[model samples]
Target: MKKIMLIATLLSILVEGYAQEKCDTVFVRASTENGIIEGFEKAGVRIFRGIPYAQPPVGELRWREPQPVKNWGGVKKTVQFGPRAMQLPVFSDMRFRSNGMSEDCLYLNVWTPSKNYREKLPVLVYFYGGGFIAGDGSEYRYDGESMARQGIIAVTINYRLGIFGFFSHPELTRESPHRASGNYGLLDQAAALQWVKRNIARFGGDPGKITIGGESAGSFSVSAQMASPLSRHLIAGAIGESGSLLGFREMLSLAEAENRGLLFQKAVGAGNLNDLRTLPADRLLKMTQRKDVPSFGVIVDGYFFPEKPETIFSKGKQAHVPLLVGWNSMEGHYKALLGNEEVTVENYEKAVRQRYPDIAEGLLKVYKANSDEEVAQVATDLAGDMFIGYGTWNWSDIHAQTGDKKVYRYYFVHPRPGYKNAKTGDDPLIKGAVHSAEIEYVLGNLPVNDVYDWQSEDYFVSTLSQLFFAHFIKKGNPNGFGVPVWLPVRPNQPADVMIIGSNTRLQKEQHRDRYLYLRNVHF
Candidate 1:
């Protein structure tokens, strides 16, 4: 009887302990000033997917500032991804895939690891990149699980894309308080950040420690946000890859965006905003293919984006914060698809001479090569330099020269062995260390496990990189375990930069002469 009683007690204790072990999932109720939203949890991380930061920009709300979501009665299921913003057909192999996308896709996703009533982890809010036309956060690649696992609450967001997201018209302006228009996508991003500031704490995220980052157009949005005083307190720092806030004056101010909207109206033959809203989401997405104009992006609106990004940064009015910036070796590695027969040495020299009359000779001398492929690679490198590299240096230079903030720059040259196309031979014919390649590494998604497997190198690179980033987010300096004593980028120490690659070495005076030559070139 005694033995039986003890066994029974043990069984009961085990059962109770099992019962007490709550599923790692967390749930939170977001109390925005607009309404209350209930978000579920996944493995101790609270996730709110497709939560509307603003009113559905449907019907008369289209092309207008994002309004607050109306109050809800009970818990709203945020399991599935929200509709994607209007976008052009992104995939090239369209023959195999249908463009099943939509326009009413202004939504955001958040992931946090804490469930305590008061614990607030730092937030990492991201914007996806697609040249203002293609990407959405729904890609299988950008899952924030690893980032959240590292204790940084992660948020991935989708904003308006293409013409639907960017179109600005005279009539549209007349309807606005700022009397200016363009870049509804930027406004959408801002709305999402505002939502983070208001409700992130409920998910155990520190609103004050939020870091804004993105790839291409997403990077442009970061620059725009940096320039906007409205977004000052919402973001702490920024990370931009292969995109900068230098050009777009002509594109943003042009009537192309408005014209594209007019085209959408003509396609549906919608009489007004209400009519446009009534059109089916599918039809709107299909109509987004009308023409590739300056349809989406932040404009030089005197209201939100009062001045050009370069002008803003030049005056040192950009958000005073630390930054981490980098670019791939071959940003235009996709040029093979362009099949340019003019990618010859003489042609490139002539082209450089014409485009950069002031420093063409210098550029040609540095990138002088023997073959078309080499010249093509040089051209891609030069383009990357002009678009991303120079901007990165200038950004670091500006901050180091003015603000008390720190700036860290990197060059991602870790080209995986098997990553080279088998058909391309010793030369990297495809996008070698191309744009967005650093993403997989930084996320630790590679599958190599041994010395022979290239993944070991990738693993170390990613681990150290993650540590650097995490350290920066947590304590402002990107120096900690496994990172080679990273120093601040100052005018006196501008030469030192963290080179993230196979060896992960620290170098000085890297790309100085290259960027110096590009300084005189026109965009």
Candidate 2:
């Protein structure tokens, strides 16, 4: 009898423990402006995935501004990621955790450390980079849980891509009350910002303390957002990495965008706007893959952009928020300059002369290479400057000269470690940090990406980098305890940039001559 009683007591205790565990891990619910959403909590952080910020942009609503999500009754489950934007597999590095591709991809994910609405935390909204053609918020490199762990509310949102997002026609302009066309993707971002301002408080995020950040094209979007009146008031700070809209690329005029749209309609045999609207999204997407099809790009619509981004920044009419921006060491490879030629000084000189015949001597003087071995690094610097570095520098310089807020600059130089279990010659030797390499480190998502054989040094760099980002998001300054001092860029002074690497420290700008020369030649 005693043995049976003991066995029964053990069974009861196990059952009670299991029940308690289940209760502790119950799904969390938050009320949004549209409706209540149910999301699961893990490791003390609440995660809400695929929460619709806008109505499905399908059928007639295609190529239009994002519409407000209609209110729904009952609790809606948002545990799974929504579909990614419509795009081709243009980049190999992107790995998605989304449902699928679709035009109805205006959703966002949120990660918060707050237990209740009263615990209002600073928020960071990150935009993914794919040159405005391909990217998704569901990419693992952009997971927000790590930032959430640092007492922040992190958000990742999806905007339309390629033709689905940027298609512009005369009819579109006629229909728009703002008398604009194109830039629908940017408009989607603005809509998402408005959504956050209206609803983030319910998720325990302070609506007034939101920071926007991105890399590459997303970084360009940051500059565009700052310049535009729509989203300027919505952001408290901005973080741009490796690119900007200032002078990197020319924004197409609405008339040029409409001409491209007309060409597309002719290519697709669409009779009119109605026919284009009825065309299947997959068919439209496949047509974009044609070589002759002009790439859909951002436009200087009178709505999202009243004028050129450069004009806005020059006039000091952009957002006056604290700006933290930088670029990588090797944004472009030497091969871009040398093409198929061998890495020789003669070949490097010939390539520079061919590209900039009138000013090759001045460029050669600025980007000097004495020996054959030195040609690769020198060519890489020049190529990187022409590619994106010069534009990023121009943005920082212009903002410092115009804006009232503090500007912090950096040059990320930490090369990612090699892959695990890789054969010899499988991975090319990386000389410096390539473009987009800083995303994982700055977001504290190194562990989320398992492809790299991360070392203790990588983790240390990630920790330090994320600390700077978190501090900036919280207080509009990257400086904090336990990190090296980062000075803000002063107008008309020699800029001090934080060199982020194994031995991260502040360094004087050594290549201003290169950037200035490129600016004079290109602009």
Candidate 3:
């Protein structure tokens, strides 16, 4: 009888533990100011979704900065993803699956590795890329489980995008403390990071060891955060992929960005901000599809950000932190589709003269192509180099020159698994590691049906790359178990940029010589 009682007690305790473990599998509710948030967990990760970081930016809050998340009552359901921010239709059936769109979209997602409730692991927060208009953290590709399993607490957030995220008008500016105009999305990012600082510890994450990272627009945000006083002390290090400090011109201020917004309003026949706001959510989304211009994205408000990110860094006004930055070798996949009909010598020369008049003559000599296709490739590669590669290189160069913190650079050259099916528009030839191609490698969650082969060189490169990133997040150095020695970048001596590929090698002139002609043009 005694033995049976002991066995019964043990069984009961095991059953209770199992039930507690299953909490992560089902809809787990979390309490927040806005309400109860429910989230799902899997593979040793606790994922909370659709949790409000701030009050819904609706009605009076439109075009205004994100407001504080008000207090909530009972356990909130965060299991389902919240509505996506207003965006144009890229996917056809984008309803609840992609369809449900809302202006009240200020929610964020969090992924914690374990429920130990005391681990306090380093936190890595990601911002998605959409040219400041087209991305969400909830995208399936951005699921942070893989990253979280690597022992870092990962969080992906949704900020306002397009006009919803970046609308700036004179009226909106007058009501501000900074008198700042534009960059409300940035404000949202700051708010999310602040939320992480305040609450991540509850999820077994260290607020002090937080690292901010992103690709493209997200990378742009990382650069901006490095310079913003409002963002100081919120971040430790950074991992920027394919975007850099040199791209500040891409960010516009309230007046400038809103002028474009006004133009868009006129084109769309909306008289003023109120009308623009009142337009049906679908219409607003449709307007974003116009491709003419959109009223969104980060801007260079003197208050929130500077006219030049480099200028701030040079003046020692930027945050002093280690940086890991890189860009893809074939970044022209999208742009080449739009331009470059034929890669003929004449066409290439003409294209160069038009796009880069100052360096056309010089670039023509270095990038000689007998066939139109080759010329197109050269031009596309050059564009990739200028926009993505240049920014990355310059960020490392400039940072190495000033701060004591180490800087590292990389060039992503891993090919995807199935390139044949993924052809786009005019440029149909296999796009050797294209822009945004490295996303899967970084996140370790490539879509099974993705065009490029993940099992090829990308598999090797990505493993190392992600491991390096994990190391950087945990410790300051990017080296870890069985990894190759990553060289630190210095201002002098070719910068020792790490070429992340199947076969990693250090190359001094990864694309430097090709871009030499543009030196006088001032990148």
Q: Can you give the TM-score per candidate against the true fold?
A: 0.82, 0.94, 0.85
Q: How well is each residue in 1-523 modelled by candidate 2, as lDDT tens digits?
A: 9999999999999999999987887699999988999999989899999999999999989988889999999999998899999999989999999999998899999999989777879999998999999999999999999999999999999999889889899999999888888898999999998999888999999999999999998999899899999999999999999999876577899999999999888887889999999988999899998887787888898899999998899899999999999999999888888888988999999999998899999999999999998888898888888788988998899999998999999999998877778842421423888899999999999999998899999999998999999999999999998789999999977899999999999999987888888778766
User: Model 3 — which ten-residue stretch has the worst lDDT?
Assistant: 90-99
Winner on TM-score (1 vs 3): 3
Ranking by lDDT: 2, 3, 1
For model 2, state the Cα shift of residue 523 in Å: 2.8
When 2 and 3 are scored with lDDT, the better candidate is 2
Give the C-alpha miss distance for residue 100 in model 3, angstroms: 2.9
Maximum-TM-score candidate? 2
Compute the lDDT of residue 522 as modeled in candidate 1. Answer: 38
- Write down the lDDT that model 1 would get: 0.69
- For candidate 3, the per-residue lDDT at 493 reads 56
Top candidate on lDDT is 2
lDDT of 1 by residue, 1-523 (tens): 9999999999999888877665534556655555566777666666667777788776777778887777776667676678776666675411111123566677778777776737778878888777777777765545676777788888888777765666677678788886866677788888889988988887777888888887766766777788787785688888776577754234354355566556656665678755655667667667655554223555666667777667777788888888876667766542432246456777777777766787777877766667876776677777666556666666566656665677777777776545332442434453456667676566544542121235467678778877777777666667888678876676645457778886787788555766655554534
Per-model RMSD to reference: 7.5, 4.8, 7.2
Q: Which digits, one per residue and each the tens of the lDDT, describe model 3 over residues 1-523?
A: 9999999999999999999887636554444434556677676678887778899888778777788888877777776677778876554311232225688888788888767657889989998887776778777667788888899888988888777777776656777777866778888999998888888877788888999999888888888888888895688899888887564145565578757766788788877777876787677777766767554666677777755677787776777888888888887642452363554667667777787676677767766566766765676677776667666666766777775689887888876555555644433654577767778787776643254435555567778878889999998778879678888886655667677778877766545665444444554
